[model samples]
Target: MKNVTSLASGAVTALVLSLGLAGGAAAEDFEWPRLLVIGTPGTSSGSFASTNGWGPILQKETGTTVRIVPEDSETQRYRRLTDREDIAISSVSASEMRYQIQGIDGYSQTKPVAQRILWHHNDTPWGYVVAGDSPVKSVQDIKNGGVRITQGVFSPPMVSAVTVGLPAMLGMSEDEVAEKIEFVPASSYAENCRSVVEGKSDIAYCSPISSVLSEMEGAPGSIRWLDLDPSDKEGWNAYLAERPMLIPAEIEMGVKTARGVNGATSNFVYSVPATADVDFAYNMAKWFHESFDAYKGTHPLATRMSMDQFRKYLNRTPLPVHEGTVKYLREIGQWSDEDDTWNNKAIETMDAWIAARQEALKAAQEQGIEVNFENQEFLDLMKEKTAGVENFQSRL
Candidate 1:
């Protein structure tokens, strides 16, 4: 009887161990991607340059190969993300994404879009630049002047705001701004900087770290960084009021290089969308977190990134956080009760916003009318459409 009992006990133990191994294998499973394409700017772009290192590291660590694909504008990347055309992730300016979602300014003609955010890397800042010899020293210097600023044709709305939002900050109407400001269109930041160098542009809008800015600052023009000084209360307040996305960021001040003068400018973070396969997203986040140390060594800008750096920007996230990322955050006890409340409220709000948007679209379609957000009737119609939606008040 004792021998028989021993045999039975050993069999049970073996079965339990086998089951545990199977569970572990499932947890460690990586979904082999057909293709993973990351949307980026041109090879020379600061945004895209970071990806050159990231692609190899991602492939090695996650067992998923990542392809670096260049795109000129956020709107262009938006199409791929919306279509889910093997585009696993892309880096876009958070401010521009917010602007696009609200369908404001140059983007007013397009319908509002909804996307998810995964991680926000804060390595880039945007602001106005000009020849150091130019007399345009401040925001006040541009008003009532014949200054032509080149707002890049393919520039993210965040970068382009310096030219347009400046007028709004100074309490001028859109028409007044249009009348006073001459906007020159260019194809790239490189061209925009050249405009400033060749005297075609008075002040240039640029990402401080771009090669174009560096090139001009080095050769074509020794540039001075222009910003709304914090000490100038009226100017600072007005700038903030006009451009909600402009946060006080410490930008690299350089005479075509790092001059070591700390200046305030607009900065943005790159994010991932929610439509990404949850398992893939979950594994991606987990892989990134586990390999955080190794990944940073991949590029110069990445040296600034950490797991906390990824989650810390959730406050300003214009869209919903990915479920996979949320899972990783929850596991680490990083996501809090406050986060839960906010996320729940946010999700409810977004759902109502989309549903109401669809309802309004249907009304317009049936009536064969255009739903202009600026029209009073459109506001009234939207109010009527969303009035019954749950948590509609919270969205307000």
Candidate 2:
């Protein structure tokens, strides 16, 4: 009887061990799709240090393995998207995406990426910076010339948009202004800041009220921010309309001081978060909109993330709303049938505008009028005026 009992115990132990091993094998066999996140290097330390900015949070929310692919430059980040990567996050402006999808620029090597833009988020602001002791006080002051502003370190798209595209919208050519100011390229934030302090550059172009901007605040009264001229409201507004991210923002001194100038009011920077994929963009939009508190808890910049802000900034642009996001917005009654009608009409109008521009270009070419692709302003005005007509047609 003792031998028989010992044999039974041994059998039970072996059975338990076998079941445990089988269970472990089954668990190991279950695979999850790896999420790839692409980001620009050196901008967000928090993002890099912590798993690609949203990787950790997303992984915790969804039971998937998140991987962050950090690229050394913005161009590299966008170029990587050509591969069959699962997800990528990079600083692609709305205009850049539009041009890429249309194959307007040199991005012809890559096919148009079929992904949903999840959500557009705010970036740090871009504004003119000057020496604290300098007599220049406003965007207008620099317009008269004698002031040299440095772009510092910016992505190719950013450079194109700001220097070429933005000035083009204002009916002024960046090249025309080239003789008036010096354009110095500083690629890194540290290098740009050092240039300003060392007097190698006069005004530095950067975002307003960023951690980097805050660091420059300690520049011992050597540098100050220039306000956009209120008189140039038309130009500014036109630029803002074209670039939805360029919202009106004030730089308060006490709230955030720059170079010891505590409470000055200036329209310095506008933050915008942009994406290329519409469905994912929609999901991201809804997620961020609904989970505002969660995001704000992660970063203070998220304070501007709101439904109203989305309607105000996003709806005005030529970019298409992610279908998923559109669905969410409609379900929440944030968007109406009229809004849909308007969007459809707007799209049709854009198509018409592009067609018209092509026709005009052909006509001009027949007449031997030199078509300057380098002049971005002319192209923008053509698009803007066309979009306006489309808006009117939609209303009818």
Best by TM-score: 1
Candidate 2 shows a clash count of 23
Q: Which stretches of candidate 1 lie over 4 Å from their true place?
A: 1-49, 65-80, 83-85, 99-114, 121-123, 133-137, 140-163, 170-202, 219-221, 229-247, 252-280, 297-305, 308-312, 330-349, 364-396
The alpha-carbon lDDT assigned to residue 170 of candidate 1 equals 62
Q: Write the per-residue lDDT of candidate 1 for residues 94-188, one digit (tens) a residue.
A: 56666555443444334444566666555455567777788887766777767788877775663546565667656667776777778887887
| Candidates' C-alpha lDDT | 0.60, 0.47
- Candidate 1 clashing pairs, residues 3+ apart or interchain: 254-259
If scored against the real structure, what TM-score would every candidate get?
0.63, 0.57
Model 2: per-residue lDDT, tens digit, 118-145?
A: 3554433455566677677765565576
Error of 1 at 182 (Å): 8.4
Residue 29 accuracy (lDDT) in model 2: 44
Candidate 1 Cα lDDT to native: 0.60
Candidate RMSDs in Å, in order, are 11.2, 13.8
